[model samples]
Target: MKNLVNFKVAVKTRECLVQAIYQMLFNNDSVAKVIDQFKDEHKTKKVDFKMFSMSLRSINRNKKKIESILTSLEIKNSSMELIDKSILFFAINEMLFGNLDKPVAIDESLRLSKKFSSPESYKFINVSLDKFFKTLS
Candidate 1:
């Protein structure tokens, strides 16, 4: 029998989107690699690969800006986990580059954190995103 645990059923949630973004970034060195990696997994879910691709592109495009913003928020500490950093990068990319709503972005980031990271990380992610938003106005 196939391992059901590896198969994620179809669902549209910010967490999944963010996860996809993180996976695409962390697992692959190029778009072709990402597509190859996700090709099998995505068959079980109705994920918007286009959206994930766009997010990846956006993040790469604004990589410098995003890094500067994160640095400004003092997130350069090596203590942070890679998952937490991915969450922050996804949240920041969607909020600042994609023009997603602040509340929705923050809430989604929190939800993602609750699922993927520690409870303690939610507050830090929220406050950090909030600070980044403040710079926009």
Candidate 2:
């Protein structure tokens, strides 16, 4: 597997990635359209198409696993904010699907939580991931 840390794209770059995902999830856009829009918006903006493509593919490929993780964590119907779900979904994507190293995945997820979520969100994410991993053992 590739080094997931090396695969760690910037938060802003990931914001673009998630935007494409959100478009797909919320707007029902096709993958090609999402990629096209992403390219048009960031073609010359130093975005890593490789990372963006990989992350997008990861999310799409692991949708079921992500959903399972959310369900397993019992947050599927909880009243937690969307940001919380986003953080958990992202972490689960990395942990249960991405080929990145486990520590790298956790770190990247925490970084994302810090950047895009509330301060307490990281702790919540960390605990959730820890419990999820424990269930795997």
- Total backbone collisions, model 1: 0
All candidates: CA RMSD (Å): 6.1, 4.3
Error of 2 at 137 (Å): 3.0
- Write down the TM-score for model 2: 0.75
- lDDT tens digits, residue span 27-118, model 2: 76777788888988888775778877887777877878787777877765456656656556666776776666777667766776777778
Query: What's each prediction's TM-score?
Result: 0.78, 0.75
lDDT values, one for every candidate: 0.70, 0.71
What lDDT would candidate 2 get against the real structure?
A: 0.71
Model 1: lDDT of residue 82: 72
What clash pairs does model 1 have?
Answer: none
